[model samples]
Target: MLHVNSRTALLNNAAFSLDVPAKIENGTTYVPARVFAEAFGGTALWSEQERKATITIGLQQVFIHTEPHKHWRMSQERINVLNEKINEATDLSSYSQIRTHFRPYFTDSFINKIIYSNGIKNNAILTKKGRYYLQ
Candidate 1:
């Protein structure tokens, strides 16, 4: 057996191989740009204006610049109305309303038991995967 230290051995043993990369930052691993470019069907470029250090990506470009008007805001009156409706909805128990709506669905035995056994006014009983309150 022979013990050999080689760069080829290290590269072969490495978890990943470097190919031309998508992104590169200074003081960090410089990825191969060409591999990602081919993979994504795009191109990477170097710019002299950017001092050649910054990697400029995406050659075929679509730059749509549009400034939306910021004046459209919900009014205080609208906010107040929304808040009032929410409060009205969440203020009371839905069980009473459910009972009133589906009173015909409850049997006489269950209603009699509910009436005698503890104040089950707002108490709900699960029936057929739906909820019904004791009237």
Candidate 2:
């Protein structure tokens, strides 16, 4: 369940609550590709097997695979501007910096990385500020 603090903001957003089939391994959730490129406007995804692994996008990234953890599956840098206002009304820099913490994209590449990193390879993901949840 994508838990945005503001239910109003979620209503205004296009892809806040995406539904797709994925795998659960090692206490982490994995999402599908549609949840990435189509859902959150992540960069492009390509496979090494599919002709030298070429995916072109405005952002610079080598490649990404699922890492497996609770975070969504994409890179924030590639996604559109997320109007996360956690600290928008607050006078605290600590709150203002919340946006700085979440990679916060539902991209195929990001999801792929998380799955590969966590479930496949078994690594520990450092926590970010935004809450991690399932949808």
Candidate 3:
């Protein structure tokens, strides 16, 4: 476990020292990935050229990019447009209507949910279908 603004971490009741303390910014907790990975018996490799970190634990590998996504500006614009639409909507009765108006900004899976599923609630049918799809 990690405490905010603290450089000490505890694992199995053992204290581990850190070069930098964990911090919270904009309601998000930020910890040294290298220290956490090493504490958990994993290895973290940094790529300066790619601006990314490759973390490996046993047979699994996870990649984390440090830079913003390529489409960040475009996504922000889309979100602004969606927010404007939401703010302007005064007569919208149902979520389906709002979703229909915002369909162009949604992904295929989200569109499928709006088209196929009844709402956001996960009933037994959706749960079974989700499990089957995962399998």
Q: Which lDDT values do the candidates have, in the order given?
A: 0.39, 0.39, 0.66
lDDT of 2 at 28: 77
> Residue-pair clashes per candidate, as listed?
6, 23, 0
Mark the regions of model 1 whose C-alpha exceeds 4 Å error after superposition.
1-59, 68-71, 95-135
- Residue-level lDDT of model 2, residues 42-115, one tens digit each, is 44555645433333344644445543345464444322233232112122234433323433533555444433
TM per candidate comes to 0.25, 0.25, 0.42
Query: Any idea what lDDT model 2 has?
Result: 0.39
Better of 2 and 3 by TM-score: 3
Which residue pairs in model 3 clash with each other? none
Ranking by TM-score: 3, 1, 2
Q: At residue 94, what lDDT does model 3 achieve?
A: 57
Question: Which residue runs of candidate 3 sit more than 4 Å off their true CA positions?
Answer: 68-135
The numbered model that scores best in TM-score is 3
Name the lDDT value of residue 14 in candidate 1: 43
Superior by lDDT: candidate 1 or candidate 3: 3
Tell me the tens digit of each residue's lDDT in model 3 across 1-135: 888888898978889887789998899888888777887799888898899999888888999998744532334444466445434343344555656675676665764654564443432221121111111
